[model samples]
Target: MKTKNIIFIYILLLSFSFAQSALKIATVSYIKGSCYIENSIQDKSITPLAGNSIMNNDIIHSKEDSFCDIIFDDDATKIHIDENTRVKILSDNYSRVFEVYYGSVFVSNAKTHIKTYIQTLNNNIYVNNNNIWVNSYRDFDKVVSINYNANIYNYISNSQIILKPLTAYNIFSNGSVKIDNNLDLVPDYIEDESYLQVRKENRNKYDVYLNDYDLIPVYGRETEKRSFDDNGFKLGLTAGTRYMNNNEYLTFGLFPQYKHNNFIVYSKLNVYYDYFLKCSSFDDCEFTESGIYSNWESKNDILEKFHLRYHRSDYNNSFSIYAGEIPQVTFGHGYLVNKFSNYYEYPLRSDFGVNIDWKIDNDFLNFKFLVPSIREYFRDGGIFGMHASLFLSHRFPLTLGLGFVMDFNQFSQSPRVYDVDSSIDSRQIKAFELDFELDIIRSMNLDVSIYGELVGIWYPENIFYFRSDGLMPFSDDLRWRRGTWGVMAPGVSLLIDNKHEINFAFNFNSAAFYPSYFNTNYLYNRSLYYLTAQPFDFNTLGFNLVGNQIGMLNDFAINSTNMEFFVPKELYPILTNKINVFPLRGFSIDYKYNFRNKIEYYNAISVYTQNVGQEKIKSQTYYTFDAKLSIKENILRNLSSLNFYVSNVFFLERDDREEYTFGFNMMFDLPSDVYILFDIGQVFYDVSLNGKRNNVLNSGLQLRLNF
Candidate 1:
């Protein structure tokens, strides 16, 4: 009787515990410092604990019982997490993970880890409101040790472990040790030593992955060549598919060039598919705003999945460019601006036609051939637009002129639309553009861009005369005429920058396109209508500079780190709370040129934060300079072990910028096809681009396979 009673109570308790554990699916849990949704009413309610969720910018607490699955539809990404890990759930959107202070999450590779230490730097680093530090600064090729208070242990082959004070260890790697020194190998530990940067074999022009490897190449450079040193040129082709944020597309292109020392000839072709017209398919797709802009395949992002490309060539990256018509800037671009809600840019362009690119920036004069339209000439199907023509003009960071246009255009003359008005002048519209600009402040970089265009049109029948701009329309019968010409208009732009910043420019066009209404059979409160025919132009906001005219919310850059910001391991976890603004991470400032001081500057304040309390938000930020310098030492000469890279961040939304990022990274390379990769991203993901947040992760790896 007693045994039966005991068994009954035991079974009841066990069932209760299991039920409680299942409740976690409904509750929230965290991985590394990233957020994850435990369970939603719509889900099956059973998942792994380390997976990412679908919500961002929301908070959730840990419930020891929660479990979630992280299933990225596209497997182009990997994830990592750290130990003793504790971070609040900011957001866990499957594709867009974002958070503040979700320290120590490294993402890359193809797989994701949970609750693991950062493994990139391969050393432990600590951060807080005060300083930075590192652990056992040694080389893995040799032996290194952690002198526990009195006792000592040895590790062989090195099992790069993220150890903290009072951690116990058995045997695992080349050697073993019993940690007892209250030592905590942190990510911020730093050691200074000189190393050699031996020069390797010279990589020739054919050595790059530009397509054909067996061919020699040559290109004529004007002043400054691109990131190339060899003179020979090779054919470069690329076909890639980008799937990030919320858009997807496939693109393929070709670049053929001949180069010498002071001159060059090059032409190019590129085309792509945007797949479908969804709101989320374009760049800068957002939640607010309305019109066809809203309905046109609205999703998380907006993109022109499909575009064309062509170009000539130029040596100076500053001026003198030849790729496609639409100015060097208008070629192959979806637009030049971000969506009304989020800020982003379309990365490529299709220069309307082909043209010649010339330059005079670097002492010598240079020239290159911009390919003309071969598509229309080939009768490959039926390509009627601009004739395959080349552009020709002078050069200067601010100088500009006009170029002839004979390119192919299909989107227009929408054969998709028929007006029976098939006259030579009315049958075709050749594209042409005249451009000009002024450079006001070259230092802080203050400049304005202006350009105009004229197209083919017909009026007095097929009798040919210069149609206003002398543009002759291609008649179906070979001969051409005048009269049928499109409207003429102009636009303008400006730009600025720093190191980390690739570029920053604003453009506006007055009536680039017409108020295009995507009126279709799908009737509703609003049709996917484009207020302006032009792409992303400032004119939407009244700037009127057609084309892609975008306004940068903020443009700053953080290039390289001083490479010195870590504490020694002997101190263990004592100073784990210190943080630095310019250590492993980079930093840049925003500034305007000051004449008297002859300098550009930004706010001198940098804030650092640390998690002093048990809560994630317990961390606080304060501004300060480093109180200590890394001492140069040669402790471990031949042994390498753990590495850590860290960062942390806080966002003051009102400021429209991130307060700062404070964190670390660590990585390890082991024998065989294995590597340990780890990193902690502090405040890496702040604003939700396209309504999505970029969250930081603490990722660790067991091995890295080089294959």
Candidate 2:
């Protein structure tokens, strides 16, 4: 009888222990050093031992160089805390809620049904795919990594960034973020089976899968499934017509593409025929000018584009190589190396080169080297360009950038002329730029950027490159030239509710700090609204003040006469050979309001002024205003759209040069993938032209087929 009573008591005790454990949300599975647990409900703090039960509202602190892991019992969700980190478990019901104060944490919840919520100083991250890592740096930057797409709302910057699969993002408090592919701290790569066994032995737990390749799919599934048939054939065509300035032309193009798993090949031929250039017979046909050919498609008429490209990457995206033509290349917000071309002036442009991207454990690096030249006009004149960027840390990342472009003609002793000849001396036009970015306010949203560039002509004949206005003149002389530029900008950003944001920066530079020929100065502000269901809402409004200066080496003889700010040495003698001393000011204000569920509207206004010391150049007050409206609908089994646009440009002190343009465009997309477009426009140049009822008509039609 005594033995039976003892057995009954033992069973009751076991049941009680199991019930208590079930009530706890999580337990400290592993610990390294200096980990403390604070219970807000109890108003008490204690050092947590491994296997200690933890409930909601429990704050965990990992001191310097310490580490700890918390495992939720209901699901196998695990949270790893890094050194100098504080995290509080707000709730752990159907979803887990965590607030990270500082430091880094890695969360891996492979259970698809489990959801995780992380709140940082500036952003809130929603994790639904189970693989995620978060780092809060000094409360100013929030950096995260995930294996799949996730939603992140930045409250401080009023913005959202869709975290793509196998990508890392460094989000700032002001809504500015940098994106990189396939980089993770703490080695998120899948462990080998042997490694998992060792982990299980060491921690007394075996939960994580060793072969987690699907956790990160390099290039995604579409790239893997897309393959070519035996013929490897695809075709596209576009035909268009235009009537403008008492002239009409027909434009047509044919494009053929071959796609495969490892490589792609394509070619395009475009031609435009002018009605005035027609001949009575084929033998009597004549052409005024020949079109240029390139390795990439030309935006202008009469051209051919032939390209071959190959790419390969691993599942985790540790290595990737791209060869052949790349259409667009931009660097560091286009401060340097924006290779997009303006076909109106430069009809020929191409990027023929190779790009390499790799990651070493935690560090990420990328390099691109290209020959930015047209293929048909090939020459051995020696032109090359390269750009590279590197990141050391995802949180408080130290980023470095470098770019260079060199040409052999700019420094030639022989005077540059329109005609090509053997007399042109072979000298190097060496240009290089270096930049660094650092987050100074570790706990706030503030960053400082510093850059230096030297895009100058090197004269081999002259040992010294600089002389006074009297000794050497730039417009006439070809001796030593000065071309050094520097820039320093400090910026701050603020956001509210992840929907509204404002960014402000003060820029000081020797010239307008854009690597491209046409670019806006610093202090430029713009707003954006992604189209959504509610179209009648006012989406964006912004204003900006800008400062500008002309650089010393602004004279690129190729098109110097056509550029507005390209001041010859003789025109601005005092401003030569200087750094960060530009004397120009500009400001702009813009707003957009969308109305009607089926229509979109946009409006903007801008103004610019020049300052020569204390004097304001009244003649340089350039003003511009633009407005556009668009509508889309389904009509007669076809997707149809109509667009209207208008722009006006004037000067504050002048009226003769004022210009206005009005345009209307229509498009129809058929069910068979054929598209038809038509555009008509009238340009009224100046008030005199408008008074005389003189307007130039410009109209065009385009037809395109795709399969």
Candidate 3:
């Protein structure tokens, strides 16, 4: 008797071991079209096949026209997925937990005592060995369970419903709900005969994948899911008419895009023509030369922006390469270079380059080589730069980089509008920059961060240019000097959710740092030194302070400048006998209030005092104030809107310098695929020399469509 009992115990222990070894969470029973499994632990996607094991935290994605079937090992429960769906496994232990983020899914547990739970954004459905079909769209959800009962809980309203078998329920994102007993004859939940026929035809293929391929799914799907324009093309068009300052023009634009796998190609083209319909040539149009129309300028037919890009992601690492007419976008405190749009009109700004980015782990590497002008080649000048940064912690990142600008014509441009007008020889500049980024605070409702950068530029004969006397041509004591100077800026930002925030920054420049040559403060476009003292050859030792705040009700900004001391110099012919200097001081503040519904108000004031060539002897001060009010309302249900705006500008010291403007705008989105917008305004400028005020009509109409 003792021997028999011992044998029974051994057999039971061996049976338990076998059962544990065979227990799989779930299996990929069938797949149609394209599907993939994203493993959370591995941070990668794996091609799955029939009989493939599903693990905890696995995300299943089905592309358009695709389908997948999953069967649990413990209870033999089945789940059928429809096209464009994502399901995540939260807990696959005893009682299963699943989240269906989009599309539709069908779950069935024929046997009693089996448990299943499915969660959506607003509700939770629990199946006590029941069968259910769920469909989730943008803001609407539907569920139908046949042959078995289920329980559902609304997370938002704390409501519960015991869903009986053969019934349908509708759940709205806005917290409304309904249930009905009648079901559709061809409900989307049930597998149709067409799909079953397809399954029959692919039975041999699935069997091969399960038995011969060892449950490894075929590599037909290139990515984990399908992109919007995957292996397809899209096109967009924008046409408009604009009338500014009594000048009118018609604008047309086209944006086309195409994507294939990990590759993308896109272009933007724009054309502008005179509204008078008399201008034969695009360049001959008066509006083309106005410079106010910055979107695009027609060269021959239109402006074209063409770029080819390749992007790939796998295993937590990503890489992207872009070439051809790329935008020059700089990040992480533009100490070295800023996009040309910051300083010039967009139509004149051109950049053709190759950009490369590679990110792995916590480190990122970036490189850029751009040509500002294609006709002039490298001699016309271009920028070549490389940058690297690493995240030391989640909230703190450190970065350092070097950049070089090849310039053979820095001082050779003809004197024109917005020109710095320097006589320095062809010179190249090499710059080095360092940045420290820190996130000081992060909470559910608030976030704060600080960023600082130190930058220096070096070049030959960068300072102390020679004074040419014409006869001798140059003075020995005033010869060029090679030097380096740095500019430093420290900025802090605070945010209370998305609605409110504040930012403050202070910039300090050393005396030897020349703004005209380096264009410091590229981030703000303020360039106080370049604007005031660049032409006078005056150097500065001062700081500029800027602050901005955005609240639920209003937005405000303050820009202050004070160059207390300057390097004394002689005014060409006026102040040669006495010490010459320039003192710069200015402050500007602006405020905007948003009622969050239909009304907005804005006001701005500025005061500046710029002293040149003997401060107390020659000085000037100016003041300006401006205000605006805007009101808007919805015209249709997310289909249209209308707005009215009024504005006034006043010059305190100049008589008849006040200006006023009023405008109305309308936007229409009645057609789902296109948008139309129109604006009309009248502007009253300062009094003309004829003792009469000048007024001009401003109007614009634009239509945009995408496919």
Top-lDDT candidate index = 3
Please provide, for model 3 over 1-707, each residue's C-alpha lDDT reduced to its tens digit, 9 standing for 90 to 100: 99999999999997765554334578898998999888745566888888889776678999988989997664346788888899886542345667899877887653322246778887788764356788876675687765444567777777555544443567776656665323342244353411222323444554321111111332332212212224788898988877653457777878899988789898767665654544669776542354344434344113226667897643235677776554545534553443321212222233335666667632344444433333223334334455565555332433344445444433222111122233223434566666655666543235567766566666543243323223332233243334444343466656543224454444443423322222211211111111222122222213211121011001100112221111111111111211111233444444555432234565555454544443234444544454555554331333356666443321324432223345677776644468887877664421122323355466778898988
Show how many residue pairs clash in every candidate, following the order shown. Answer: 164, 5, 0
Off by over 4 Å in 2: 1-232, 242-247, 276-304, 309-325, 342-363, 374-377, 380-383, 410-428, 439-481, 493-503, 511-515, 518-668, 677-700
Tell me the whole-model lDDT of each prediction, alpha carbons only: 0.26, 0.48, 0.49
Instruction: Tell me how far the alpha carbon of residue 591 in candidate 2 is from the true structure, in angstroms, after superposition.
Output: 12
Q: Between 1 and 3, whose lDDT is larger?
A: 3
Candidate 2, residues 479-529, lDDT tens digits: the string is 222353323234333322222233333323332222232111100000000
lDDT, model 3: 0.49
- In what order do the candidates fall by TM-score, top score first? 2, 3, 1
Error of 3 at 572 (Å): 15
Global Cα RMSD, each model: 33.1, 19.2, 19.2
Candidate 1 has its poorest 10 consecutive residues by lDDT at 516-525
Pick out the ten consecutive residues of candidate 3 with the lowest summed lDDT: 548-557
Which pairs clash inside model 2?
Answer: 156-495, 158-498, 465-480, 509-580, 510-580
- Please give the ranking of all candidate structures by lDDT, highest first, separated by commas: 3, 2, 1
Instruction: Point out where model 1 deviates above 4 Å.
Output: 1-375, 380-398, 408-426, 444-707
Residue 607 Cα positional deviation in candidate 3, in Å, after optimal superposition:
12
